[model samples]
Target: MQPQLQQQQQQHVLLQQLQQQQHVLLQQLQQQQQQYVLLQQLQQQQQQHVLLQQLQQQQHVLLQQLQQQQHVLLQQLQQQQHVLLQQLQQQQHVLLQQLQQQQHVLLQQHV
Candidate 1:
């Protein structure tokens, strides 16, 4: 009976230790899964940031093109205005010359 009791006590201690080891292994597995989830989330965030940067770069390029087009259009409009002003000045000069010639003809006829 003494031997049997000793054997039973040893088995009980071994069973408790095995249960503790199993609990520790389960905790380790949970920790590893949590770490993996965190890593995946970080990777996803990195990909999203890269995509946003690319989009911003594209937008910057497009904005630059628009500004360049606007500048070219303004230059063309300025050139057209300058040409129109020159034409008006030339027409006024021609009209003034014609008036002077008509007046000179009348004065010669009267004399």
Candidate 2:
């Protein structure tokens, strides 16, 4: 081959190799960027999951407190009902005693 033609062919091959290397480097950079985005998304999801668990725990605690308050209120109502029942019984006893005394006086007068 002529010397100038040989040098031109070698230069062409070198240029093609450099272009291929540039393309490969571009592809590698794109893949790395995609991986970084995925890692960021995964971290966000984990943070959201942790926040959801904390909210659920708080809800459970509030529910337990509400149930305890309801139980205490129920106990107070029952005690009030028991007191009212006792008062009614005492009033009935007093009325019965009064009726018996009035009957005894009427019977003596009739005799």
Which candidate tops lDDT? 1
Q: Evaluate model 2: give its TM-score.
A: 0.80
Which window of ten consecutive residues has the lowest lDDT sum in model 1?
94-103
Tens digits of per-residue lDDT for model 2, 30-65? 999999999999999999999999999999999999
Estimate TM-scores for all models: 0.75, 0.80
Q: Each candidate's lDDT (Cα)?
A: 0.98, 0.98
TM-score for predicted model 1 compared with the true structure: 0.75
Q: Any runs in candidate 2 off by more than 4 Å, and if so which?
A: 105-111
